[model samples]
Target: MKKTEPHSSRSQQLEGAGLGFLIGFAGLLAFQLLGELVVRLLAIPVPGPVAGLLFMSVFLLVRKRTKASEPEPLLNASSLLLAHLSLLFVPAGVGIMTHIDRIKDQWLSISVALIIASFVTLFVTAWSLKILIRFMNKPEPE
Candidate 1:
């Protein structure tokens, strides 16, 4: 009689997802630490983790562009995390609950800021895309 291995397709997928999460968490920590070091060295106003995130974004973009023909393991891994990303906001929601009094005091300003920022971001994104499409379609100068 042949012995059957305990590993199965579902188990493999679960393992992959778990590994992906660990990789992403490690990447986040490494990037944040690097960003912190750079910020301290350069005396930048932005937070280290924010800078690190931007750096990671650029790295991911470049990697994707270069590996256009290849399968994107990192991208896929990150996408898996993103699929359930709303869960990540639960902590933030809880924190907000704790700050209800402060939120109430500044609700007006916070709402106004959020509305203005949303509109501004939408307008800028649309305008930039429009410009990019036009540039891409424009005829080369003689």
Candidate 2:
């Protein structure tokens, strides 16, 4: 067996991470494209990115159900993205700034809507997670 150099292992890891990031980014773009097509074809009101998210979620669930091994590249990519998730909100922050005048005019409505949406999102997420946990923990029938 050949002895591995310390720098060689580190370089390999960096290369793997770089490849994982590219693959993950590509996957994201492909899903978004699929989402855009679905929305346009169906004339749906939902955003393409949201539709793409649903597609990815379904894909993950199906893969899990089929006992298919999750790809490390995808996982690594997702982890890297999630690690900097706060950065993802920067665009939305800039968008809000652009619509400052409109938001000011509709401050009350916007505030109420934001509050209600937040509560609803939190409640739904909690409920779904609870249900999923229960399902996962269910005992197998003998």
Candidate 3:
């Protein structure tokens, strides 16, 4: 009789994880590409990556409503991306360092603007949230 090797659960899990990562990465790239195309074609003010994220969000929302299951590939990919999210800031940090002299020259103005913007954003967000909650929680007419 020929002997057969037993299947290992750990190997299966590892394979699934690898595939999920690939799928997730591919999805992110695809969305970014779509975003770039849309921005270029429409001359939209928003950045390509930001547009891509909006597009992806709409796509996911539609998919969530239409499909019974969650998007495993996108979720897995996003999780992987989020895990090393801080790395994305490295380039921005480097760019800021390169512009250190310019920043130093306008530091006071920039700091004041940033602080004002932060307060404005916080107030607007809070006001909007309160309005939305009130609208949503209103009792329906009998």
Candidate 4:
């Protein structure tokens, strides 16, 4: 019987992460394509990629509920990427640096828009969750 070396273990870990990333990326692309198809078929206004993310979320939820024995390797990979996700936005931040003047010109309006949107989103989310909880807690009629 042969034993696996320590370096081999490290290589396997890297391979796992790489494979996981590929799986996640493929899943996202497939979701986006399906969403785009559905949107086009239904004449919906939402962007395909956004719908894809929603689809992916629902898939993940269903997988969690039904596939108890299968470990979620892709989800773990996605979460690992998310954990260090700020690095992914560094290029966007750098690009923003080059658009300083344009941002300055529209800073006030942009800031106001962000503030309003943030508040509205916060209020709506809170209100909806509260209503949902109240409805859930209500006793059924006898």
Residue 105's lDDT within candidate 3 is: 97
In lDDT terms, how accurate is model 1? 0.81
- Superposed on all Cα atoms, model 2 deviates from the true structure by an RMSD in Å of 5.9
Q: What is the lDDT of residue 50 in candidate 4?
A: 81
Q: Write the per-residue lDDT of candidate 2 for residues 1-142, one digit (tens) a residue.
A: 9987887898899898788889988887888899999999999999999999999889888888997688666667778889999999998888877888998899999899999999999999988877887799975433
Give the TM-score comparing model 4 with the true structure, all chains together: 0.57
lDDT of 3 by residue, 9-128 (tens): 779899998998898889999999999999999998898999989988999999989999998988888987899999999988888868889998999999999999999999999888
Model 2 score (lDDT): 0.87
lDDT per model, in order? 0.81, 0.87, 0.90, 0.82
Candidate 4 lDDT over 1-142, as tens digits, reads: 7976887788899898888778876766788899999888998999987888788888878888998754455666567768988999898888987889999899999999999999999999988877887789975433
lDDT of 1 by residue, 2-115 (tens): 977776977998898778677766776787899999999999999998999888888877777887653345556567768999999998888877889998999999999999
Off by over 4 Å in 4: 1-17, 97-102, 106-142
Error of 1 at 43 (Å): 2.1
Query: Per-candidate RMSD vs. true structure?
Result: 5.8, 5.9, 4.8, 5.5
Best by TM-score: 3
* Evaluation by lDDT, superior candidate among 3 and 4: 3
Worst 10 residues of 2 by lDDT: 133-142
